[model samples]
Target: MWSRIRRAGRVTALVLPCSLLALAASQSAQAALGSAPLTPPSDASVSSRVVQPASGTTQSVMRSESSAASSTSSTSASYTVRETTFGNGTVVREYLTTSGAVFGISWHGPQMPDLNDLLGSYFPQYVAGVKAVRAARGNARGPVSVDDSGLVVRSGGHMGAFSGVAWLPSELPAGVSGSDIQ
Candidate 1:
């Protein structure tokens, strides 16, 4: 029995890393933060028609009582957002400057969007900051925040519902405030 357990452990150790690698590689093409927005991932049903200005709305079929029944977006003179709604009812809004750089990203839904994909080059910094905060706070639960030098992230919610926003302060366009990202 002990030998069987040992063999199972070895198999798990070998398979876990390969599974993680596959997951990392299989991520659908997603727009990275701080870069120009790319096309939304293929899994998402994009908005087909443009509604009137400042009220661009799209319908999405949602699960778990969290449908983005009608996704609405607004654009100001200084910046705009490209919003995408995933199959799980998660809505990601990539805020762009006038010059087209993605300065911020926000999400809200029954599931969390992939920050690793959205944060792009900033993912490492975000991870380090989250670790530090956890270490300092002793595994306390509730909202999690990472306020790095230029990156500001705030996320909080219970199971089945989550929301968060992250933004690069230096990249925000003129006349655009952080409040405008959401």
Candidate 2:
């Protein structure tokens, strides 16, 4: 009986080692075949190759020209909030873009008690709400841009709310009206 027990212990140890070796060998084989081992390029090397200029003098000149152009364009495209009060005690503030885009709109006063509640709410539900409106009108296809400022309701296409105060786009597809939402 003792001899049989000793033989069983030796067999168990040998089998365990063989199983571990097989696993390691299989993993190495997979890596060698390019099936698993892969690595990303180093960040320093990637940036240096992509952004290096032909010459130092040319890089300085390019940077200066870009800065000047950005300053000029930013000044011309600045926007301001334009407020208007309707007879129904509702105050609407429209943020007009100098480049001709109504970037934002805000409403307040007695008509909407929780007017300022959504001032900083980043409600993703608003996106679903707008898409639903668009889908219901059967105009879900074509070019559409959606913007959420996390403080205000902003979109690219016509989003209806108040009378005559449609979210009109400066450039929309032909035959699409400011009233045709969706």
Cα lDDT, model 1, residue 12: 32
- Per-residue alpha-carbon lDDT of candidate 1 for residues 72-150, written as tens digits (9 for 90 to 100): 2224334555677775677887776655677888889887767888889998989888888888999776688999878
TM-score of each: 0.67, 0.25
Give the clashing pairs for model 1: none
Which residue segments of model 1 deviate by more than 4 Å?
1-29, 47-76
Please write out the lDDT profile of model 2 over residues 54-164, one tens digit for every residue: 221211122232232232223323332333444434445443333323334444444431212222222344556568657877966533334333222333323333221
Question: Using alpha carbons, what is the TM-score of model 2?
Answer: 0.25
Number of the top-ranking candidate, with TM-score as the measure: 1
RMSD of each: 8.0, 24.7
| Model 2 Cα shift for residue 105 (angstroms) | 0.9
Each candidate: how many clashes?
A: 0, 1
